[model samples]
Target: MYDYLVVGSGLFGAVFAHEAMQAGKTVLVLERRDHVGGNVYCETKDGIHIHKYGAHIFHTSYEDIWNYVNQFVKFNNFINSPVAYYQGHLYNLPFNMNTFRELWDIVTPAQAEAIIAVQRRSITGTPKNLEEQAISLVGTDIYMKLIKGYTEKQWGRSCSELPAFIIKRLPVRYTFDNNYFNDRYQGIPIGGYNKLIEALLAGVEVRTGVDYLKERALYRNVAKTIVYTGSIDEYFDYKLGQLEYRGLHFETERLEEVNHQGVAVVNYTERDVPYTRIIEHKHFESGTQPVTYITREYPAEWKRGEEAYYPVNSEQNQRLYQQYAILGRQEQNVIFGGRLAEYKYYDMDDVIKSALECVHKRL
Candidate 1:
């Protein structure tokens, strides 16, 4: 029997397995999918490395997590500066001077500051909803063009329905910076995340196309402890109601030309657009090939059987997750983790930091 049976070969599983092995423990990693690296998996087609899942840009403020991931793969300097397109008008994201200039032709920081100050002063009381929050922070023009429709479509709810707390603050910068994440380090791995996972679990025994739940009894009997990174609610057969998540559907295609879009990601913030964003795969790699690939990302409602993406952390869902969490605590041998397991939406950096913390506490 192995010391640990790590289920799901995502970042959480892979990192924990690697660390456990390093601590002189025998670990077995089982992945439900045919491939490893979980959602961060990439494949080369027509000389283009396509992100099979979504575009995962690694950005983290935590230095320990940054240094830890750097051990496996060399990262490229791919700063994520996503462009927002609303009704044929493009603006640099993160509400910077460039965005303000594009939005209102305000050239100076003082002009932008005066505009925002007036807008903030116009809103009298405390903001109650997302619409009020946006108006209070960045004014009507930027809110309407950039945030309103996109956010409404993202959550599939009216701005009035969404709580103001959802957007605590809309970061408005006086400078001309457009980098989305306020992280010290940000980039994609040189070879891709798949290679990084492969390097991380070099010596560990990994079996792809192996569903832990399907072989639950046998696997549990074979391992001394279980490190599960699947849905915690599923582990208990949804005794507590299943937590909700907003799923995404990606439609990918390869083109004959070397370039598709100038940038890696271009978000369509208008309500008219069905898809949220278009990702040009080659831009991530700085590729100079005859053919390039692109993907259209469409947000969808998460079903029971489908893969969960963004957690629907509404009041009801939070309560449901808490109930499942209570059940998780009772299981001494099982370790529930990752976005799916915990029923929480986490960026790549957050997942790494979380995995590190999990490993530290468990072993």
Candidate 2:
């Protein structure tokens, strides 16, 4: 029997399996999808790594996490500076000085702050919903132009209908910086995320297109322990209730030109525009290929039996997840990790860190 039966070949499973193997443990990884890497999976077209799920720019402040990933695959110096397209005007993201300058034609930070202060006076007391919360944070102009449409389209609900906590804080910068994250390290894998996944699962046995949930009886007794990285609710057969999730639909196109939008990512902030952002894949790697590829990403409402993306952290879903957590804690020889398993959103580096911690505890 194997020492560990990893139920998913994603980052968490791969890392755990790799670490367990290093500690002299036998591991078998099973993936439901035809390929591994989970959401970080990339499809290659003309030497350009097309993000199969969405634009996943790995950014982290932890030095150890950064170093751990670099051991498997080298990373590029790609920084996320996504531009926002509203009506006919384009502005920098993260509501920085460059964005304020583009909006009110003011170069100084004081002038920008003054403008935001004046606009923010429209809201008083505690903000009720997402609209008021956003306006309170970044003022009316930025909220209306940048935040409102993009956010409404993302959740498929009006900002006024959403909770105020949905947008706890809008990133407001006094500098002319457009770097989205404040992390010490940020980049994409030099040869795409597949290289990292391959390196992690190098000598470990892995089987793709195997639904462990369906064939639970076949593998349940095959190993001494199981590392589950899929949905927590689904693992219990949804006996409690279904956890809500916001799905994403990607429509990728291969263009004959060298460049399309002149940048890696551009957010279309008009409510009239259906898609949230268009990602130019080549720019993520600074490819010198003859052809380019782009993808229009649309936020979708998730249903059962569909691919789940972001977990909806609504009040009800959280309560239901707690019930599943209780059940998970009672299950022996089973350990849950990663986004879906925890019913929480996790960055790439955070997930890797979690996997390492899990292995440390196990081994």
Candidate 3:
């Protein structure tokens, strides 16, 4: 019997399986998708690596995590500076001094702070919903133009209806810097995430296009321990109600000219606009190809059997997940990890760190 049967070929499972193999254990990885990289999988077209799912920028403040990922594949210095388009105006992301200057024709940090403070006065006492919370943090102008429409489209719900804690803190930078993440280390894999995944799964056996849940009987007895990275609720057969998630629909188009959009990511923060953002795949790698590929991302309501993107961390869903967590603890030899299995959103670095910890603790 294999020592571990990794049920997903995502980062978590790949790392765990790799470590297990390094420690001289037999591990088998199974991926439901046709490819092994999970959502990080890229479909290359005309020398441009298209982020099939969406734009995934890896950023982390941990030094060890940065060093650990670098072991597999080389990463390029691609900083994420996403731009937001609102009402025919372009603004730098993260509500920085540049954004303030563009919005209110202000140059100094003091001017920006003064304007934001005055606008924030519109909300007083305890904020009830996401709208008030955002306004209280970054003022009405930034919230209205940059935050409101994009957030609404992302969650598929009006900001007013969402919980206040959803936007507990909106970082307002005083510098002209447009770097989106505050993390020290940030970049994408030089050749795309597939290289990283392939390197991780190098010495391990993997089976693609294999649904473990459906063919449980054939593989259940093959491994001594099961490392499940699928949805936790689904593991228990959803006996304790299904959790909610926001889904994304991507439409990728190839154009003849190079550089369709100036940057890698552009947020279309207009309520009337159906899509949330447009990603220029070529810009992710600074490709100088004769043609460019862009993907327009549209957020949608996630239903059962559909790909779950971001988990809805509402109180009701958290309660349901807790019930499933209890059942998960009782599983004989199954270990749950990764975003889907844990019912939480995880960045690439966080997920890799989690998998390493899982290996150290469990293996």
lDDT of 3 by residue, 206-263 (tens): 9998999999999999999999999998877888788898899999999998878899
Estimate the lDDT of model 2.
0.93
Clashing pairs for model 3 are: none
Model 3 lDDT, full chain set: 0.93
Model 1 error, position 84 (Å): 0.9
TM-scores, each model vs. reference: 0.96, 0.99, 0.99
Higher lDDT: candidate 1 or 3? 3
Model 3 misplaced regions, further than 4 Å: none
Off by over 4 Å in 2: none
lDDT of 2 by residue, 1-363 (tens): 999999988889999999999999999999999999899999998999999999999999999999999999999999999999999899998789999889998989999999999999999999999999999988999999998999999999999998898789878999989999999999999989999999999999999999999999898999999999999999999999899999999999989998898899999999999999999999999998989999999999999888899888677788899999999999999999999999988998899999999999989
lDDT tens string, model 1, 1-363?
Answer: 899999998899999999999999999999989998889999888767799988999999888888988988989999888899887778898899999998779799999988878877767799888899889988888888888888887888888898887787888889999898899999998978888889879999999998888788778777888989998877888886777778889999978877877889999999779888999988887888888889999888888778777787687888899989988989978888898888888888898788889988877
Choose the strongest candidate by lDDT.
2
